[model samples]
Target: MMEERKIGRKTDLRVLKTQKAIKDAFKEMVMEMDASQITVKELSERAQIHRKTFYLHYTTIEALFEDIMKDLFQEYCRLIEQTAPDAPFDEVNRVFFTFMSRQEPYMERMVCAPSYRDFSDKLFMTMMIHNRSRYNPYANYSKEEQNVINTFLCLTSVNIYRQWVKDGKVLSLEDLIELTNRLFLHGISDVRHDL
Candidate 1:
């Protein structure tokens, strides 16, 4: 069983607003410089909040980065859940690509920035943790094997997405989704598994 922490509605609203401001500031700052270059002082100044208030919400910039990743992962899970259980690969891919397309600029900056490579790696690991069950069909394999497979798949997907963003998304959303699905499902194997 899990314990729930309760807070007054007013306090909850204030916390949410402050967190959003901090995130917005971070995003804006990332566009200008690397995450490593973003100091708490600068972030607080950009967010128009005191440095102590930032500390109250997050212990460090890395914590804030993790929180942002958590938000994205949750949003992705929500979108995936909304998809029908029997949804075809194309449908699921459409949903995912649509979400990614909307967040393209921010994602591109985050992934391409050298200083944030560690953060990107951590984000991928976090996503893999959240998605492990979805990839666990080969029950005969050991946990380590399953983890290796999952990590490979996740890294491949991330690289493809990074490439798409780097290319300025020349392909239409639907086309990109189809391309990604086809590549992942078939992988030049010539075997046509109806994904």
Candidate 2:
């Protein structure tokens, strides 16, 4: 809107506004359809920014998606870190679920939208990479054991959370977290009777 001035290390306000517009438009598209289907032409139109302007901020739609994912992953790691350093794995995941439960609609869609599997998968893998350093549940077990256990723990929990969201959260968030912890600790056979 204003003349572009040399802002040095700081981002131009116009640039920030344009980026936010692009991001907001992309988010709307994600909510409306699968993320993979979004195109720059539609996003630029929706953002009311020129495609050239969009390029000034992000090289590709995938880049924008990764930018958003990085912000999300950072926030997730921060929340997970806030829990006690040596917290039990279940408790650590409780922190994750709690953070997830509090997401805004756009972010919730990123995690729970059936068409956004790539988005969700990216989020899941990012969480796992960080968790390896933060909390290793199977500490006493071999690396392979830890790998499988952590994958199972992370994957099942996120999917359970995803299913819960898709089902319109039939169980309260607290109940879902409790049930997830049960599944992690007791396994399916043990929880089958309760289900």
Candidate 3:
């Protein structure tokens, strides 16, 4: 869905403030609990907006989360396009990890914290969906096949990214990206004869 369609106006200060407040409230609640556990009633109260206002802005918690993620995803994708136009799928992880590492402090808590693994997964899944046209060569594959491939790549990458964050990023971003690339390409059965 278009962000513009969901948000009726961008130029109005009241609209911008309401959006920010809603996002800020979502972030705070997300840090405290899983995304699934949050409710519009609680979120609206926290944002100091009525539930109707929240509904006017977001139909569901997931929509709100996706909206927030799309903004970040677009920012990083722009940077990646500039720096690595037509970069291979493996290299895409580098930009993603770097982008995650550079997120604002409030986002760090929401994106990096262990309790928010779902958020991290959602973010990576969003990237995979958005990244398909630009990076996927398997577009010729059947729809089911594409889903399987996308699911494996997204979940595997998100888990690795999560572990890296939980372990305090012992591996440098480049190293971590390289690790994921190897796993994605080789898929553990490095010995082709065994497969």
Number of the top candidate by TM-score? 2
Where does candidate 3 clash, by residue pair? Answer: none
lDDT of 3 by residue, 1-195 (tens): 588755665557788899999999987886778666889999999999999999998988878977887787788668677644457776677777777777776676666666666765777777788778666677799999999989987787766766787798788988877777777777766534652
Q: Rank the candidates by TM-score, best first.
A: 2, 1, 3
Error of 3 at 112 (Å): 5.6
Task: List ranges where model 2 is wrong by over 4 Å.
Answer: 1-11
Each model's C-alpha lDDT? Answer: 0.76, 0.81, 0.77
TM-score of each: 0.80, 0.87, 0.73
Tens digit per residue, CA lDDT, model 2, 103-169: 8788788777776767678778778878777655568999888778777777887888888888888
**What's model 2's overall lDDT?**
0.81
* lDDT measured at residue 192 in model 2 versus the true structure, 0 to 100: 78
Error of 2 at 55 (Å): 1.5
Per-residue lDDT of model 1, residues 14-121, tens digit only = 999999999999988988887768999999999999999999999999999888877778887888777665566566557766876777466667865677778777
Q: Is 1 or 3 the stronger prediction by lDDT?
A: 3
Model 3 lDDT at residue 90: 69
The segments of candidate 1 whose C-alpha lies over 4 angstroms from its true place after superposition are 1-7, 84-94, 189-195
**What TM-score does model 3 achieve against the real structure?**
0.73
